[model samples]
Target: MNFPLHRSSAPLAHLTPALWRRANRHLLAKAIAEFSHELLLAPQAVSRGEGWALYRLETPQSEYRFPARRLALDHWLIDAARIERRVGDAPAEPDALAFIVECRDLLGLSQDVLPVYLDEISSTLYGAAFKLQRERLPAPALALADYQALESGMTEGHPVFVANNGRIGFSDRDYAAWAPECGKATPIIWLAATKRLAEFSHVDGLDHARLMREELGEGTVARFEAVLAAQGLDPADYWFLPVHPWQWHHRLAMAFAADLAEARLVFLGQSEDLYAPQQSVRTLYNLSRPDRRYVKTALSILNMGFMRGLSPYYMSGTPAINQWLHALIHNDATLCACGFDILREEAAIGYRQPYYEAALAGNGPHKKQLAALWRESPASRLGPGERLMTMAALLHIDADGLALLPSLIYASGLSTEAWLRRYLEAYLRPLLHCFYQYDLVFMPHGENLILILDRHMPARVLMKDIAEEIGLVDRANAPPGAMERIYTHVPDELRTLWLLTDVFDCFFRFLAAILHEQGHFPETLFWAEVAGCVQRYQADTPHLADKFARYDLFAPTFTRSCLNRLQLANNRQMVNLADPSQGLQFHGTLENPIARFRPGAA
Candidate 1:
C-alpha cells in the first residue's frame, strides 16, 4: 500500500526526529507506569529510598531501568530523564513501540490486536509530537488562559490511557486541521437529510424551527433554504443537520451513497459558525458565539477503545433525560448548595440509513453514523467574575514540566487544602450525594466535567457530556422510560466502586500524585480534605447515613476496575455502553486512600 498521510510536506512537519524521540520517551514512561499500576508488568526494585526508588523492568529481550516515586493508589511516577532501555548491556533507545512489542506476551496482545494496538501507540506519539511542536503555554500562563485555550493546552489527553490520543482514523491532514490540540477554528459541514429518514428530538420548550433560528440566525437559515430551493427541493421536506467535515467526505458520503444519490441526503456545504474541538474529539465548542450550543457529531475515529459514535435510538430520549435530570438535581437542595449543575443536551438529530438500520442488529458505528447533538454551553451559566476550564486541566502538566493545579492554586490566592476542599465541594461531594441519596452516577471522569472557576479556584462545576455517560444505579429513581438505557445493574458491592474506582482510583489517583509531586502538598492531606468533604455532606444529610454505610466510601479496599486492561483486552468496543457493568475487567483491589479518615479509625 502506497501511504499518503505524509504526502503533504507540511502536514507531518511535527514528526521530526527530535520531537519523535521526546514523544517516544514520554509515551514509554506513561506505558510503563500505567502497565505496572495495572499489575500487567511487575517491576523489581534495584534500590529504594524514602518516597522513591530505582526500579528495573525486564522482559526476555529487553531490560529497562528507571527511578520512580511510588505514590498513593499504586501510581508509579517515573523519572523520564533517567529511564534506560537495554538490549544485552548495549544501551538501546526507550521506544514505546519497542516496549509494547517486548511486553506483548505479558499484556496478552493477541496476534490480530497487536499490530492495531501498535498503530494506536504510534498515533498517540504522533499527537504527542504535534502538541510538543506548538509553543506550549506553561501552567502559570495557562492558569489565566481562556476556556478553549485550556482545552487545547491539555497535552495529556487521558492521564491513565497509554494510547490516550490515538485518533487512529484521522490522517495527518485531519490532525493539523481538526485535532483538539491543533486549536483550529473548524467550520462544520451542513447536510440536509430527508425528514422521512431523519430523526430530530428537542426539549419541550424549543421546537426544531426555533432551535434553527437560535443556532443559525434567521439570515443563515434563509440562505440554506434558498440553496435547497435552487435545487427545486422544498426546505420543509428536509431537516438541516450539522456534520463533521471528515465524516461527510470519508464515511457518510460512501456509507450512505445511495441516500445521497437518491436525494435523501443533500450536502449543503459548510456552516459559518466556527467550532473548536474540546478534549473529547467528537464534541466541538462554538468559537464565533461562545453562548451557542456545542455541536457534537458522529465521529468514526477509533480512539480510547471505542469507535466514537452517537446512536439515533439513544437520541430519542436524550432531551427527556436531560430535562428530567435538570429538574431533579436543581430541585435537590444539597446538590444545588454544592454549586453543582449540568449542561443539558437540549436538542439532537440522527439521520437513519434504511439499509444499515435493516441489516444491523444493535448499536455500532454504522447505525450511529449521521447523528448530531447540540449541548448547552457554560458561557451563559458563568457568573460575573467566573470563567470555565475543563476539570482535566487540573491534572495537566505542560511541556515545561509544570502542573496547572499548583499554578491555579497560586493564582487563586488560597491554601492548597482550601482549594482542594472547594474543588471537592464542587465536584466530589455532589457526586457522593448523587450516588448515596439518589442512586445516580455519572462517568465522572475529568473530561466529563467543566469547572466554573472564580479566579483560579473552582467555585462551582458545570457538568457536560451528560445523557449518554450518566447511569442510574437504582432504576426505580428514573422516570420509567427516561433511564432505560442509563440504568446500570452494578451489584450492591460494586456500586461503591463508582466513587472508589472511577473517582478515587481513576481521577483522584492521578490528581493526588500530581499535587504531591508538582506542589509540596502531602497525599494524606489531599485525602483528608476529600474525607472532610464527604464527612460534611454526610453530617448535613443525616437521613442518608444508612445509605452511606451500605455503600461505604471509607471501605478498606475496593475492586480495581482497570481502564488500560479494558482497552488492552479489546481496543475496539472495550465495553458495551448499554451494559457497561458486564464488561468490567477487575484484576484485584486497591486500598482506599480515604479509609484512614473513616470515623473511629486509628
Candidate 2:
C-alpha cells in the first residue's frame, strides 16, 4: 500500500562520452541519409579515388560527408564510420541536438516548435546512451532469446525518422521507470472511474467483473472493494481503469484533485501484476501472467511527433473495429492460409474530466490522459513449439555487424532464400489480400506486427495496436455501423500507399538492405521474391482479378511518402489523425523495386 512516489532515475553514469558520441554519430548519420532522401539535404557526390562516391551535405557553418550508396526510392545506405563533421576548419564530432539547431532553417522548424523538437532529439540521444550500456549480444544469440528480449533490444528508433525516440515528457526518472529499454517490470495504479463520467466498451462474452477477477484475483478485488467501502463509495457504481503510474504522479493527482477528493475517482492502489513496457512506451505486457491481455494506457508524452495519448473519442469505436477485422480475417481463406492473426482489443475504458472536456472542446491535453484498453495477448494463442517476437527484430543488427535475419535463417535449418520466402509468405500475402479483397489496410510497420516463430522461422503474423492506426482508404467498401469510423475517401493514387509506402517502402526496404548487407539475400532477389509472392497470391485468387488491377501492387513507381519530412515540418502532431492523407508528405516518386518482376513485365 505504501509504494514510493518516485523511483530511482535511469542509470546515466554509463553514458560515457564514448557512448554519447556513438549515439550522436548514429543519429547524425541517419539524419543526413534520410533528410537527403527526403530532399531536405542536397548531398553532392564526391570522388573517393577508389571508385566509391561519398556524398557531402554542406551548410554555412559546417560540412558533413559520408560514404553512401543510393538504392531504390532514394534510400540512403550511409557508412557511419566514414561520416565526417567539420566546424570552421576544425574537425568536430556530430551532435544530434546541435545538428538540428544548425539545420533548423533547412528543416523548416518553426520558432515555437524548434525548442520542444530539440528536447525530443535530446531525450532520444539519452535513450540511445542507456541502450548502449547493456551487453551487446550477437544477432545469433539475440535471435534465440524470447519475444520481449528482442522487442527491447531494438536500438534504431524508426529507420527513417530522425528523432524516433523523443519521449519529451519523460524525466530521467520516468525514463528508468517507464521506457521499454529499462527492461524492468512496473506496477500500475488502478482507478475506479464513476460511471457517469467514464465510458467503457467490451465485446460480448467478457465483462468488467470477470476481467477484474481474472486480472486482480478475488483477494485483491475484495481488498479494493473494502478500500472503496471505507471511503463511503460503492464499487458497483464505478468502472476500474488502469492508470499509467507516470500519469498519476505527474498529471492526475493534482490536475484532477477535486475528483479524487470528492471520491468520484478512487485509487485502488497498485495491482499485483508486474508489467514490462512495450516498444510504444504507453502499452505494457503482463510479465506476471503472460496469457493475460496487454494494457495500453495514455501517457500524453510527445514521442515521435505526437502526444502518445489514447484519445477518449477514439476509444468508443475500438472494440467494434477489432471485431470487424477479426471476423473478416477468420472468414477469408486467403488470410487464414497466410496465417495472419490480429490481437483484438477486446475492451477499452476511458475516464473523462468533465471540466477539461468542456474547456478544451474534448481535445484538451488531459482529456486523453486517463484511458486504458485490454488487447488480447498474442502469447495466449501460441500453439506448441511457437514463439513470438516483434517483427522489428528482423532488422536488428548487433554491434558486431551480425543481423538477426540471417541468424534466424540459420536456426530455421532452411537456406537463406527459403527462409526469406517463408517470412514473406507469412507476412506479405495477407497484406495484399486484405487490400485486394476487403479494401482494408493496417499500419503494418515493424513494431505493429508480431512474428510467430516456429523453430526460428516466421510462421504467422499477429497484428496489434488496432482501432487507432487502421484506415480504410476506399470509402465505398466501408461496412455499415461502428466500422464506418475507419472509412476515408483517400484519392485513388494514395490508396496503393497502404501497401507501397507502409509495407514495401517502410518495412521491407530496411529488411532487404539488412539481408543483402549480411550476405544472405541479394537486393534483386529479395524484391524478386516479394514480386513472386504477389504473383502467386494473384494466381490463387482469380475471382479478385479486377480488384487486383484496381489496386496495383506492382506499379512502376509510387509516391515517396516521406516520414521524417512530416516530423520536420511539424514535430508536434505530424499527421492529423482525422485526415491522414492531408498530413502526407510526398516527395516525388520511388521506383518500385519489384516493378521489373511484376507479372507479364518484360
Candidate 3:
C-alpha cells in the first residue's frame, strides 16, 4: 500500500522556548521537518496555533492530541544564515531534512498499517541522492571544510574533519569539540553515506556493511532497491557514501526513517502514543516521611513492570489504586531512595527490641520486628501535630472506608449507616484531631495516601484495624451516638483553634520545607505572605472567630462554614475539605470483599 508523502516549505513556529534554547539550528530544523511530515499523515488533521502545530486525530471511540514544535526549524535556519552573514559568507541550505511520525490506536485495529506507510514515504521522499557536478566533489565537502578553515578562530581543541582514504573522518581535535558538551568522547564518522549510497571505512568496511544489512534486513534492503529501481537506477553500481555520525543519531532523521519503514509494512507500525492512552488516570495518596521514603524506594524496583503496563484489577469494585501508585513510585525514584534508608533503619531497630518481651507475653515474633521498628526507630517518630494532621487525613479515608469495612468484617450482604456511624464514632473521631496537632498535611491531590497505606499497614493491617484504631468502629460494633457525640465532645473554641492552626501550620510547614530545599527566595516571601494573610484575616474579620465557634458545635455546618471563611479570606480561592466532590467515592461493589457485610454486623 502506498501513500502520498508531501513536503511543505511553510515556516515553522511555536518551538518550546526551552527546547529552542538547548538545540542547535540544524537539529531544530530537522525536528520540525519530521514533526510536520508526521502531522500530514496523521489520522486526524493538524492545526497550527499559538506557535505549535497541534495534531488532532479521532478514532470511532476517542480523540487524541499531539503538539509538535513550531518555528524551531525556521529559527535555526535563520540563525545559521545570520552567523554566515556575520562572517561575510553566503548562507547555504543543505538538502538534508528531518521528520517525526506518530501513529494512534494501532492496537485497536485488525492490522496496523503504520510501518508500511512510513517505508513508502521515506524511501520515496528522502531516499534519492543528489547528482553533484564532478568538479564540485572536490569542493571540500561544504560546511565541514569551511568550519575547519576557521580553526584558528575557534577555541583550541575544536572539532576538525578531514577526508581520509576517500571517507570523511574526524581528527582527535574534532572529537574534543563535542567532549565538553557531552562529557565524553564523541563517536567519529569514518564514512559519509548519501541517500543512494552505503558508505564504509576500510578498517571495518565489510563488517560494517554486514551489520547494517543484518539490522536493516533483506526486506528493507529490497524496499530501498525498489525505490532506486523506480527511479531507473541500478543498485549494484551505486556508491555507498559516508555520512556524519551525528546525522544518524538525529531524532528527526531517525524518526523519519522509522516512520518510512513503518508505513511500508503493516507489521512495523508505530505504537500508540502513551501520552494519549485511554482509561488512564494519575493516582496519588499521602504518606509519612519514613513510609513515604520506603514507598519511593520500593517503587524503583517496579519501573520495568510499570512501563510494560499492567492489567486493571478491581479494588473495592474500582480499578486498583496500586496500579497508578506503582506508576508514580516508578516515576519518582528520588523520593523512593530516601524511603529505603528509612525502612532499613526501621527494620534494624525492630531486630534489636521487643521480640523477647513478645515471646514472654506468649505472642509469636510475627509482629516483633514491626513493633520494634515502630517503637525504637526515629524514622517512625512523628510529633503530635504530624500525627493529628495524619489522623485528620485518615478520617477522610475512613469516611469512605466505612462503606467497605462492614462487609469485610461480617461477610453480610446488608449495608448499614448504623455500622458506618459506629465505626466512625468509636474508631475514627478520637484520632481526627491528632492529625491536626501533628501538623500533617495531605499531598496536593490526596493521591499519595495509597503510598502511606502500602508502607504502614502493608499486608496484616486491614482497613478495619485502621478504622478501629482511628475510632471509626466501636469495639463491640455499637453506635457511639450522633455526629454531635463524635465532634461535640471537643470544646468549641479549642476545636476551632486546632482546626485553624493545624491546617495553616501544615500548609506553612510544607511550603517552607519545599521552598527552603529549592533555595527560592519567593518561597520565603510566600511564607511571609501566608503569615500576613492569617493576621489580616483574624484582624479584619472579627466575626471569623465567632463563626469558628458556631461551626464547632454544628460539625458539618461548621466545616463548610470554615471552608467558606478560609476561601473568602484567601480572595475566594477554594479550600479543600473532606468532601465527596473531591473524587472521593463511597460506593461498594460485588467484587470488593470489604463491601460485603452481614445485616446488623459491624
What local distance difference test score does each model get?
0.87, 0.83, 0.23
lDDT of 3 by residue, 33-121 (tens): 32222231233336765534554433333343445432211111111111110111332222111121322232211133333223322
Model 2 ranges with Cα > 4 A deviation: 1-10, 48-51, 362-364
Give a tens-digit lDDT track for model 2, residues 236-259: 999888989998998899999999
Candidate 2 residue pairs that clash: none
Per-residue lDDT, model 3, residue 550, is: 51
Q: How close is candidate 2 to the true structure, as a TM-score?
A: 0.96
For model 3 the TM-score comes to 0.17
Q: How well does each candidate superpose onto the true structure, as a TM-score? A: 0.97, 0.96, 0.17
Which one wins by lDDT: 1 or 3?
A: 1
Q: Cα RMSDs of all predictions?
A: 3.3, 2.5, 30.5
Residue 506 of model 3, lDDT score:
24
Q: Which stretches of candidate 3 lie over 4 Å from their true place?
A: 1-293, 297-418, 425-427, 435-602
lDDT of 1 by residue, 293-385 (tens): 999999998998999888888887888889889998889998889889999999999888999889888777889888999999889988889
